[model samples]
Target: MAPDLPVRAHARRNREKLIATARAAFATADGTVSLEGIARQAGVGIGTLYRHFPTREALVEAVYGAELDDVTSSASALLDELPPAVALRAWMDRYAAFVSTKRGMLDTLRAGWASGRIATPTTRERITGAIATILTAGAREGSLRADVPPGDVTAMLVGVLLSAGTDGTSEQTGRLLDLVLDALMVRRGPGT
Candidate 1:
């Protein structure tokens, strides 16, 4: 049954708090933090945690979904506020940060994906669509190469993340992302 107004408002706050705590825990822990600890860290009761997320997998999936939602949604918003190439670069930087945060959650995420608690296709499509939107804008504005496919760019990003693994340094990731960004930019005439 649906909760009453006050109860629903309280639940929403608790859920948001839980997600915030989980994000920090997953970003720093070594993939072994407990759900009870997460609840305590969020300052919520165990029952409240279970009310929002019945299982560890559920909580992990929610965190991942929330991250993906933010990154994907920012693509268009960034484009509106900046040039296409700049927006794409900004989005890529955000994506790299998300990937770094994801490293700590790798184990739980892998298990969740294997158990079908996490839906990979939807996530993949959403990310790819976001890249496509940015690339489409870049092409229209003559800032990025029109010949390169968005899927190719998405694949490249996935490759970068996989290669970075759990221990890649920020400098290393920045250089790698710069390479990808360089590849996507339109070729300029020499000294023109």
Candidate 2:
């Protein structure tokens, strides 16, 4: 959104800064950082942060939305530069990163939802769309299975990430992802 004037420009800039700093804190903190702290770290007053985000969930939505931007933007890049299967794999890797961040902010995110603070779609749908885009490309190239729905793949990945987050086991995530990928790959039934 292009601002027609300088005051709107400053508001845009302030909101961007708030989102950026809140994201860093969400990713790095022990999921305990509050809105006041986020505002302070962003070098803005609490009032300004509240004026912009209005609530914790609003700030969280901003952060989660930025992550959607990252995943979808990377998908475009991978599609432009790499083969379908390779691009899909790289996007899966980004999924892991996204899951990691999501887990870190789990508590705050949940709290926001519980309080009805953020009104936008959660990261789930956006992430699913991003995965579906890659999977559709892979299917067109005869790499991934065409029958499975993208929403199913998205649900599977989210379930895997959640389980991996709970178990705190790195090996499980890779193994589970391989199983998911198996379903998407060209079928080779029963020992080739």
Candidate 3:
């Protein structure tokens, strides 16, 4: 058992390295990136890559799932460090990064999802839940509006991100995000 432990640990490390390398490649790759290239970049052999992910679709699915998990889980962590409204804005930036990463795998993801080769994740639901958590906290703190539905916020965010496009500059994206945040913030009228 002791001997097996080290081997397993090494394998796990290799697997994680592959996933991380693939995520970075997919984030910037213009089109389909080669699996062999990914394996080389991860400092592993093609066989190791195959051992961890049997197919290209499998790798894409894993990367997508990992990105989804990161973005969804960041909301509460941001809230802990910042006010609710600020947390929401930070979460949006994270969400935008998630969207950008997804672009490289979009073709494979769509096909795999359409053919049911990959299990469809509850992506929209999970994202909406994260938004709801921050929005609820903001509402309680009087930093954000209380009347907006979380789903609406989700829809608007999608629109903003999609409009930004892959070619959109960071400044453009930031401005768009600010507009969305402005809509969610509570308005203070004349002096109390």
Candidate 4:
């Protein structure tokens, strides 16, 4: 099958530049980066940024979605490059780091909500699906509990973020999740 070369090519470049700029901004600014900053960094006009994302929420959505996409991609890499347990553990740790950065993103999302910016449900769903895929693989490989749902793991991780957004929460959370996973491990019956 053939497609329109020029139009598709231009769109792809714009999208890639936007995502790259957003990632750099997050890395440097740690969620304090502004929309105009992203536009300038991406070498696009504010109008063009608006054409792609009419509101701040739209831009934040792109950043969060891109981060999740990275996480999902890492899952595949970890699976291929490491054992199931190691990969899952690495994924969990990365998820923790993401949660730490996401606090500021939530504020942006709230502003977007107040300003009538539409939420991107599809992005959220894709992230959920990616985690589920990786978790299922880990469980099947006996590195994680089969009884646990990927959605549940996501919820638990998120819960940790909410509960410990301050006052040494991250420190406690790592230990808590470690214990939970330990308890949830599948053990043989007495005679099995």
Top-TM-score candidate index: 3
Q: Which ten residues in a row have the lowest lDDT in candidate 4?
A: 118-127
Tens digits of per-residue lDDT for model 1 on 1-192? Answer: 565888888889999999989999988886587889989999988999999999888888899989989999999999999999999889989988887888778888898888888766387788889999999999999999989988899899989877876577777777888899999999889995
Error of 4 at 77 (Å): 3.5
Candidate 4 on 83-190: residue-level lDDT in tens?
Answer: 666676677787777766666667776677676674534544555666676667767877667777667766776776677665656668788667656654667679
Q: What's the residue-level lDDT of 147 in candidate 4? A: 78
TM-score of candidate 1 to 2 decimals: 0.91
RMSD of each: 2.1, 3.5, 1.0, 3.9
Error of 3 at 51 (Å): 0.5
TM-score of 2: 0.80
Pairs of colliding residues, candidate 2: none
Better model by TM-score, 2 or 3?
Answer: 3
lDDT of each: 0.88, 0.80, 0.95, 0.71
Off by over 4 Å in 1: 1-3, 190-192
Query: Relative to the unseen true structure, what is the C-alpha lDDT of residue 14 in candidate 3, on a scale of 0 to 100?
Result: 97
lDDT of 3 by residue, 65-113 (tens): 9889999999999999999999999999999999988989999999999
Residue pairs with clashing backbones, model 4: none
